[model samples]
Target chain A: MPYSSTIAGTRYTFPDLRTLLACASPPRAGDRLAGLAAETAEERVAARMALADLPLKIFLEEPLIPYEQDEVTRLIMDTHDAAAFAPVASMSVGAFRDYLLSDAATTESLRDLAPGLTPEMAAAVSKLMRNQDLIAVAKKISVVTRFRTTIGLPGRLSVRLQPNHPTDDLGGIGASILDGLLYGCGDACIGINPATDSAARVMALLQSIEDLRLRFSIPIQSCVLSHVTTTLDVIAKGAPVDLVFQSIAGSEAANRAFGVDLALLDEAHAAVQNLGRGPDGANLMYFETGQGAALSAEAHHGVDQQTMEARAYAVARRYHPLLVNTVVGFIGPEYLYDGKEIIRAGLEDHFCGKLLGLPMGVDVCYTNHAEADQDDMDNLLTLLGVAGCTYIMGVPGADDIMLGYQSTSYHDALYIRSVLGLKPAPEFEDWLTAMGIMDAAARIRPVTGETQKLLAALP
Target chain B: MTSAPPDDDPFAFLRAKTKARVALGRCGDGLPTTRLLEFQRDHARARDAVHAALDVPVLSAELVATGLPVPIIVQSLAPDRATFLQRPDLGRRLEESSSAKLEKGDYDVSLVLADGLSATAAQKQGAALCALIGKSLSFRCAPPVIACGARVALGDEIAARLGAHLVIVLIGERPGLSSTQSLGAYITFAPKPGVTWDAERNCVSNIGPEGLPLAEAARRIVAMTALAFGIGATGTMLKEDDALAMLEGPGNSSPIDGHRDLQG
Candidate 1:
């Protein structure tokens, strides 16, 4: 009955729980007690308190990203289908983020009934560039996760500001969709919603994201708070911000599958010993999970490789800066989950829990599901560069590139050109000549109008 | 057999393909506990008195009455135990502004209600699940709002200021003495404001009466938010109840009925 407490100003300590209740294992009283005897993680810390009569600045959810400037202006003008921008049945539930911020998907005659080359989205982008050589000779390292995405991504969009994150990096929703998730996430990485902004709005969105990461220099990794609001905002902002706690939100909504909870390393070593100045400034609170909690995998919760090393040594025993993620998902559903055995149990729980310290991440999605294709988005982005999976979080006009631009089903637009081998890939005229959004078309096909308005904006 | 609704689909649904199934491991739903303490001494009242006697709004994101937005976060269980144990991070976020100033926010779909960890399940369904999920998404709602010092990512930071894709927070699930108001749902899809909880995020937890009930957890949170945007991603992988309980096969173990596995 003595955990530690204060009350008025704030002071509740865990200090490691009598050395884990003495090798723990007791708690199951009242209704059953799912877990909490505390053999160590330092006797499961349990109760820490200081209500100061409750409600300090608190507020919890606000924004740098929580939509409503007209549903993000109708999902930035979402074109017609692909399950109306990444959401399928239930009469297209809640109407696909307002059909991609609808104005009829940013008009321009939707690039003349686009799909660009239209010979059925150029045969589903030549069957996703010929099925990008799947299972690549069964190499199968399969399983990883400890932590990745130092910061930024899920895809096509992600932003939840209050660190001054309100709605405008000078509007136009940050050059249309948060600068394509900080320049299409090849590792500038992103994801921040720790209850929708404020810690001075996530430190003013990381000081306005280091002026777009020094003009996209891209080095933003680590931001996931709550084990007490990133340990009381890293102990009231001496400033370092690279958190990641636990509780895979009921394993992504009622067991889709990405489970493990070791109390996220005593709430990330109390948020890096109450906010470090050294020890790499604090970045290992890893152990996320997924199977469609919000969208599947993440800048963090990309989970699956199975219990990711007792969930990364229960977050590297009080946070030593571990890194584990399992990012794996393809479209949305054709029915009954697998997404390749949940990315092979999140790459076998980060390749056997990073040999004990925990580090095996591989998140991949691309999205736009309504029965996804383009060979399920180029075989899940070539299965994240042949499954080494250190990291990957997508969305930039993804949504299976908008269901291969609405193919009326030539096996869902050539199923990623016969599954990624690709004597075919690149359609909508090689993605409008790799993002110029048009021009390189020697004989591409759906020329119609600026290549079907850039294949009706991907996903 | 008096049913017709409830199967909204949680993408991983089970409870036997729905008939509004309720024999009572928990089916209390219409706010019982003596009418939830007589609707808290009344006035304006939940669903506004069955929507002023049926003018509508007696709860409708329809799963036979909003279930998915399951937040029950509450936190002050035994506080005064001397400064409530030091402060406990003050229990994350949520203070005065209450129902977060009744937001009436930019809306697309936002369901908040805080007090996390347990304030007695935020006074049981914090103001009746934000007045029944804003009267079931108020018919393509544009003004539905309610917050009370939120925190499970503050509804993805107020769903990034209401650009809202899907955010059914609810709050207050952290009490134990068996049950203090259980409730929990931290759903997310397009919901904005800093969006983190990785692997996307999803939940439709034991909503009162024990767990997973409120009209089958609002048809499992409108069928897992239409399957987290039709399976792009979300945590703990729930593709149609773990793929129909692994096809209702593999040694068929059996257990799932309520009380979240009776706590492992």
Candidate 2:
């Protein structure tokens, strides 16, 4: 018996100290220390011996601190209360995970555990899960989902009209918005990022979208992602402010580059709440994140990019953002290296975000400088669709001239919906029907003459 | 097996004087354990700084206590941190309600305090710098305006509204890993809303304990403001010629002209 166990036809080998040390970074080391803080001297001695073979520098980096296990244990108990599962507290990490993956009945119970997972608890529990288990958890979480803002209702997948313009060119952006509307996008928000960082330009862009919404009676939301401050300005001006947008990262420095924090998010959320926009009093903030942002900002804390990306979900959860999508492959080859890494990161972010209780999505994108292409995005999009992604960026022609990248396109959305039997958000679907963009059968129809005339006049 | 002794902290000497990540060497393929831990700690601090809220009432009271001028409260269009981050242009302008409250006045210079990326920086450093600048100027200075959710260009709007000849905006700089609570000063002449480029401003950056000492930063700012007023221009044409070497106290030897190239 070489310290191996088999369950569900897959075997997991128990690790030696060296393997444990390699996997256990300083944060996890601190967590282990805290976990054992209240134990008896004898038990502490045993735990210490188990970790004693680690490099001395690892101990120096993380000081031993007292922590409350009851907090985590209580959360787990609460989750277990909701699910039909065996007591997992007494099991070792591997044993607990193996028990969960032993059969379909156990695998189906995984979603019950999601709400109870803090990043620390998740990291600990996840270490015991295989890649397949992670995917299984994602598959479970994505089914029958909706955002806090109620954009992605059951049986529907949301889409954002990212009519990005290189300059504050209203004509180009308006045309793109029209095209996206024609193709049944913007169930999420008509979010735009103007190239120029001017206040007037942002306001003008926002005002244009507001006009479009009012004129077309489009019940969806609109956002001009200039900066949080600019969005606030638009709101204060009594202009149409549907959702505030900002790029976020796991670490503080990366967020500093994005120029946002929890306080900023709270303030924006409060401001939007005061305005009382959107359906069912929905959340009024939208956030985007990427894997390499923290590392690029030099604030990743030596953690793996995936873990750092997961920590960012904690930040997003504070704001209760209506939308949270990772621009997974947009960071290029330096951080993620290749298509394989990109796909893994996309899945990891989706799983982690869903586990942390957020409406997760993916861009399914790649830049020209990256080691990815349409095929890579295609594979990711199909998987994400099956994984129940809340939404994806709907850009024209799968190429964002402003962002300088190729991403999932409207046709791709149609393809995914056809394969997955998903529809656009309910409210948006009604608008599409009214405009004759989609028929009673939910098939894309030829552009109506009236809608074409309206689009022609927009530019 | 015999193990190697822990590598000495290469930045130990510099760490005592500055928060800059100096002399931190790599171990294997990543940062040394000490450096990595410090990085995490610093990253947390920086995030905390960005998220820290400014107690506007308290800040207003403290500025009045400094006996310079009664601070006027103003607000940028950005209502919160998220909005401020998303809308840099909005941060540069005033909210409509605030615009209505800002009464126009003729003054030599309009001093503005804005909570930029770090509210902590603005609240802690604004009053002291204002007091120091007050000592050097004999001209009528506009009552200092403390604007929340503001950026450097917000001064332009406030100054234009006040009909001041020059505007000196003391705002928070973006928090770096090492230093989270650092202040910056941006001066513009004949400041207005449109047609103002980055090249048309003068900036004094990194004013905090870890960077430029407050007294020296204040002195340099006063000198530059006076020079700009005298020359009837600011920005690329303006230069910091006056030496305030005495203000740079012992152990404060970091470079101070970091913002010289900031202008377009």
Candidate 3:
């Protein structure tokens, strides 16, 4: 099958006009366009190589994330009652039995059991778990923040200052995560969601960073496609010809809002199709399978893992092979013994798991599968990509991100968690200085870049 | 290095200082040893840290793979770093044969695990975590491969030539440590080179020992392979019917608050 589309809907491919504008080693537009039309697998790789030749600074996502606030406590008080799964306590007989059988309870009981077998004590333990909420309290959670504070990433870091207008154009948190990646990967980028990636918003944000990149003699990273809304509305409005996939259905918002649903992709795809679009112009990419079915298990969805795998395989067979994306999101609790089921279901059977003969592309939440270490999370994220997630959404403060300055295709994930879970990390200051990213930080330090550096680096 | 003055919290500042050291090492950063806490922080993520620490880093995955070990390394092959993101092939092979001298041997199972594109993968257990694999598996084992630059097929690539019953690789997982540096394994009933990602591949991970143990990971992989055999799969033909059904299911949901209710 030849990939042919009318002018209104061209195949999503190559460097954005901005890449053309910012190319340090500019080719004749005629040659560039000609190559694009005749792009073979090798040519695409070549174009990608040429992309890397551009300054790393150009790729930085626009408008950094200002995570460090004097008053900014990284730990949010997550009241157990407010959580969607809070009802786990008001569990039915089935729920209690299931919990008992779960790895979490069996491996590590949720309750603080006592020697006393008194009914009162036993009842208290159950009630406590039912009412339980854990807080990761610390006098200071500044290691990571200090590092970022000293050495700012390529994106704009918004200090707590409220913009004069109710909304600032830079797209804030998502922008910052994307910008840093752009600066790191130096590839063509397109973000989903209005605040994250709208064409106008993207251009606006990039344009805002020109002065900064120039001060550093680097090009501002430009978004080839800045799409907003995971809803079919944006794609129908007119998909970007250069964009490949739209990373959508994030886990946090959906998980926080409802629970999870791994079996909703088919219906979600149908909804988009009902809107009258058949991936002809461009391909659609989903990050996690949850946006459609929020908190339903795979087996509960009337299918087993293999059935889901077949459908996923079928969907990839139907969509772009290079871009066979089944987005997955993570909320850490699922891996706690029996809590492992959701993690099990949310996982998209790695095409690599079956295709490449390796297990890859299953998105489980919580940085340290064992603990919450940003760097460790970055490593796992990177490994997952290699294992075969076309992309994995990640948090901004992930350590390996800045240290190695990596953003590989096979090992890519979105860093949306950065915005929603922005917490002050103290160690970021030392990392910045050690990695020599401090000077770069001052370049786009949205507010008080130089001043913050001095204060943070002070003994 | 300055010796630490005795203090109430011996590993405190360093522990604090090394927030996500595991991820940094796994995501193509240098093999991490400095600034790392040797033991697992939560008893759940790791079964026993001191035991893991005492074990040689080189043989950790095998010990972790006691039940069985499957090693793999997957990376993009694009030659340059910039292009690797767009071209995945580059990340799959080490620039040079860093493992050529990796004591070629024959045994019941030959295993090698690489971090391929994700460096944090290798460090999720912080150290090679040989003890995790060793303490769990009480069987004759082959030597292990713990390299910085590794790939998924490398396990089979080496094993294909090794002529072993099984060849497993547990490379550094790509960093996503906050999320996880999940270990991936490649298994072959009768190992040989030229095995593609589509053929005879089986894995067991999220093996936090407590959360998901290496021994249990072994159990699952063995189960996956046994099922693959019963179905008579040849890579692409293998039907992994319900291998990963629970991860995404809400009933399988594990909330962070340490408290959760039953689904149904």
> What are the DockQ scores of the candidates, in order?
0.01, 0.01, 0.02
Candidate 3 wrong stretches, greater than 4 Å:
A1-459, B1-108, B115-148, B177-182, B188-195, B198-200, B226-264
Instruction: Give chain A TM for each model in order.
Output: 0.23, 0.78, 0.32
In candidate 3, residue B251 scores what lDDT?
Answer: 24
Q: What ranges in model 1 sit over 4 Å off?
A: A1-390, A395-452, A455-459, B1-264
Instruction: Give the lowest summed-lDDT range of ten residues in model 3 chain A.
Output: A131-140
- Over the stretch B80-151, how does candidate 3's per-residue lDDT look in tens digits? 322332222333444344434444555555555555443444556523344444443333566555543334
Instruction: Tell me, by lDDT, which candidate is best.
Output: 2
How would you encode candidate 2's per-residue C-alpha lDDT over A239-283 as one tens digit per residue? 777778888776665677677766787788788888876656477
Which regions of candidate 2 fall more than 4 Å away from where they truly are? A1-92, A95-112, A123-132, A142-149, B1-264
lDDT of 1 by residue, A248-267 (tens): 42221222233333343355
- Give lDDT: candidate 2, residue B254: 30
> Which candidate leads in DockQ?
3
Evaluate model 3: give its TM-score.
Answer: 0.30
lDDT of 3 at B176: 32
lDDT of 2 at B93: 81
TM-score of candidate 2 against the unseen true structure: 0.54
Give the Å shift of residue B99 in candidate 3. Answer: 7.8
